[model samples]
Target chain A: MIIIEILRYLFGYIEFRAFGGFPDRFVNLCTKEGIPLWNIKNAGGRITACTTIKGYLAVRGPARKSGMRCMALRKRGLIFFLKRNKKRVGILAGAAVSVALIFILSQFVWSVSVVGNTTLEDEYILSEFEKYGIKVGARISSVDLKEAAQTAVTENEKLSWAAVNRKGSVLVIEVREITVQPQMYDNSKPTNVVASEDGLILSLDILHGTAEIQPGSAVTAGDLLISGVIRHRDGSESVVHADGHVKALVKKKETFSAEDFSFYKLSYENKRKIIFFFGIKIPLGKSVPETNFSEHKSFLESGEMQLPIGIITQYGAVYSEEKTNPELSFQDKAALLGGAMYAKKLLDYSEIKTSSVTEKTDEFGKHYEFYAECEQEIGRLQEIYVEKTNDIA
Target chain B: MPKRKKQQNKRKNTPVTPFNPETKLEMLGNRELIIDGCKGIVDYGENYIKLNTGTVMTGVCGDGLLIKSFDNEIAVISGEITEISFVS
Candidate 1:
């Protein structure tokens, strides 16, 4: 318990706190070293030195004979006098600063990093590992690096295997991502092209085999869009498989404007953060005014192998709200609406091709409308019409 | 001259032990001495006797004693001597 208190006392110095009393031995040694009498203060107000060089002479009478003044000073606690003799605050601060600096220097990882992975993503792996104490600036000795790294690898599905190693202060993690191979299908078997969804036929191009449907034909689900049944002129049916690219003119209609009264506006906010140890929080500064600010926050945790040491870098969005004013021009509102729609589209898909753009204006607001056609080759699922098992049977 | 003659007679009567050039012996009392050759304890309490040339001692006795010599040179033991004889 005393040891803990001592540590706390020492740490308090780091926080710029001064505890009363001089360290007994250091003061005594300093006194013997002839470190000016005025420079010394005992635990009590003994006043070992006075500017009147003959200050020691004042005790020559009855007080000196009995040594009463010295005794009284000792009784008053000589250590406290020494404590007052000098600037206790500066000493405490210096000691604490030195200790803190040494401790931080000792605790810091000589080297930090991530390992043990391919495919799951290096950044993803590193992010998860940051929570484990194996990150940059974290004290290496105080953390169970191996345990944290291993635990992280086991918990994440994408990382099939992981191991962490520490060499000095450097943390190394070796990992293996989950492996997957697409299921191979026998392409030699004849198959027919079937409609994946019910839609009016847009366009079809049969590279090999025969087309069963024409343009503008309304087709239902499971209907054959292309047939692999090839015919022989000799009155015999030879079913040949079909393989080709099929394009369709599918119509989709969607509203492209947000309600003016309910639209969310993102206002950039700058928050100043003060970092100390593992804790981080914004202590001051504002990115946006409170009236216009909307709070948004997200947290992701990550760490090394088996250890739980990691960091959580929180994401926050502060948005501002402005009152709808008549000053906002129609053209400006149209452009903003277009930008919002485009942003929404970009968020939903990786790529978009704008086929056409249209504008609409109403009493509420102005909006830009668009009729864009996008072609995305989703998957390699071939339709089956004739079964190869039937041919063998 | 008389002291020299007496010392020579004493040497003729005493067996000469030659020490290897590398031989050395340490004694107590924090003192070190090198000898041409001397029999019996090379070092006594607080005394050190060492041989750098070629010399030898037959017996010795004391605290903290050691004997060492180069190959085929000499040896100094620590103990009291029961017999002493001069060898040609």
Candidate 2:
């Protein structure tokens, strides 16, 4: 189709009609100008001459000499070039055939891609598309891509939202998987105090169950903070596990350090671009001018053209990345560690946080230390202290 | 540069006859100019109009009229003047 437009523009073909005796005068004038006489065709009373720009000038003199009037078959300034001495019959037929072929090929699907699929594989999603006749090389114009995509997304119980996009020759199927939490069940089992971490208990509170330890109590791993038991007024005892949480204070001590070497540098580079014909890449821009460049690229294959409906053609760009890293100074290192310490504080509410520092500056480098006392929540177990008769409330 | 030379040659060739309403001056190259009643050529960048030889016709050259000599050649660009009668 594009080739035909280019040919038509290059050839500058125009149709001209003459009334009265202008046609014969024009033919005679053109013949005198070295133009072959057989090139002029007589259609009805109007004579159409396929001649070059030079031949058109040859007819100008005779046109002025004779009072015969002439008008171009097409509008003025519309024709770019007129093909001199070429057969027009076969040219028109060939153009029609080419346009028809392009129109027909535009109705089919060429490729399908699935994105955002973690547990569900791309093959599985494509198989679902096949069930709806949305596979590669299928006629996409006739299929409802939205309906099929919605049905496919709902088919999986894990998917919350699904979207299908048709761009050019590529079909993009995006699925948003639904997150499910573990189901909780009601059970009648003894609730024991479980140690969240290996820490010594500093304080404890017992509202219903018996107190297992007092303040400043030293406890090891998995030491019970409170006992889940009940004493009735009838001199009878009924032991029931706690259903609510209890509060406690514990001291946690941890130490960490590193004496490793790290290097810093900057990166600079150029990335390449790809040229495509139809839906295929033809490797256009590869050899770049520089080195030491970090590059990342993403391709978009979705519906930009609608002939084959949801089929998309992939167009991509390469992004060259540049990074800079500088060596840390004494102040800069302290500031960096200060931000890290703040982040650590956000993770846990430390009661008393402190840092012990020692600096050694030589040809190598310098280092420091950071220590913190973190106050955190530790779970406790409690039971009802009321008798069985009071359980009615 | 060549175009400039051609223009200079054309100006040198055109004759400046006296304001005769009936006569017309035609220029050839820088070498020659012709009036309705006379035939002559110019030289270098000077204002002289020398006539061809062996002709009864006559006209003013630089400041005065010069008669024809017998040894001059008759050519196509320079022709013999016909109907050289005085106009009122």
Candidate 3:
């Protein structure tokens, strides 16, 4: 039924009224002539009906023969509708222009986004893309995205994999950075393992070198712990990189003095004030009185497009200094000062085996002395350059 | 002459069968009626509509009888139909 209605609309139709003469005879004549008519009704001496435009034109002859006068009341359908709204041409023109604009804009990239990059900056990736002619506003058809991605991965040593994709007007570049591994010295070069610090050798393990020093041997800084020069069976010598781990007992010492100290205790007051400007906030309360307080600032972002304008809140706390008086016996005070000195010395050693503290008093001041024996790695790699000799044998 | 008279007598005794024309009538609830193979409208009023179907005449008695559509041999009638009857 809807298809028939649409067809009627396409071909155009007419709603008409007939009066006078014999209405029944008029209907019979219309049906006989195959002039389709619908929605026919009679009220008093008048008859109303709707028919196709062609039928309406053909209907006049039958209507005349039946002695009825017919008059079309209205014309309907797409053709008549267009003719009625012909003067309003701007609407149709605007629709066409908008469709063309959308098509043209979609063929070019409006923005470029970079994702999955950590150490490599977005600017660096964008610059690389620019070198390959893949930039914002560039025609999508002209850019070879696959070749661009391959170039991006190969040009940057930090990137292991890279992919480029286009979504509507946006071009996205995704990159995966290579993980860094610990540095390993070149084994092909001749190098010696030497003592990094002065100590008595506690243990030694040589994997690819001759031992230059034995356990319990005293050595100073820069002394060779393992020799890269190897003695062959034929009384000849060959140089290879030395690899070894040497643990040594190193001694550390420090001195401290008993003194009055001042410590800062920090507390925050809840009082705050906020001033907003263009979605950004400027806090205008009391400033921190001392430098010992911690400050926390938070920024609130706005809009789905992530506009730079946002609210900023600054939280501050003030610190007040409290002087402390020493309330310890003579020996206890000396031990307290000695512990402080030992803590400072411990940073230089990996592990402390034993320690001792001593105190002395003089006219200058009361002093505490501390000493500790620490175990630490003492081997350091040093490259050896050997001159090339003509004798290959 | 006797055979001719018997034939005439047989013809005279036979009953005349009316022409049976194809007519389709569809009623939706008590609100609308669609008549196909309609020949013409015999009578039309606010409360009643009578249609000619060649062999028989169909009449619809309603509260507000209206012809929604009529084209070719089809007619769509809509109203509060109270009764439908055929007049031979």
All candidates' chain B TM-scores are 0.22, 0.25, 0.75
Off by more than 4 A, model 1: A1-108, A116-123, A130-132, A137-142, A181-191, A194-225, A232-243, A247-262, A266-268, A276-316, A320-330, A346-354, A359-369, A373-393, B1-88
Residue B3 shift from truth in candidate 2, angstroms: 99
True contacts kept of 2: 0.00
**Candidate 1 chain A, run of 10 with poorest lDDT:** A13-22
Candidate 2 per-residue lDDT, tens place, A50-131, comes to 4444545455566665445556555222244123214666766777799997787666666677888888887777787778
Positional deviation of residue A224's Cα in model 1 after best superposition, in angstroms:
6.5
DockQ of all models, two decimals each: 0.02, 0.00, 0.30
Tell me the whole-model lDDT of each prediction, alpha carbons only. Answer: 0.47, 0.49, 0.79
Q: TM-score of every model? A: 0.41, 0.34, 0.37
Can you rank all candidates by lDDT, best first? 3, 2, 1
Question: Which segments of candidate 2 are over 4 A away from where they belong?
Answer: A1-98, A101-188, A194-226, A231-258, A261-270, A275-279, A282-327, A335-367, A373-377, A380-393, B1-88
- Model 2 per-residue lDDT tens digits across residues B26-51: 54542333455322221101122233
Question: What would the DockQ be for model 1?
Answer: 0.02
| C-alpha RMSD for every candidate | 19.8, 26.3, 16.7
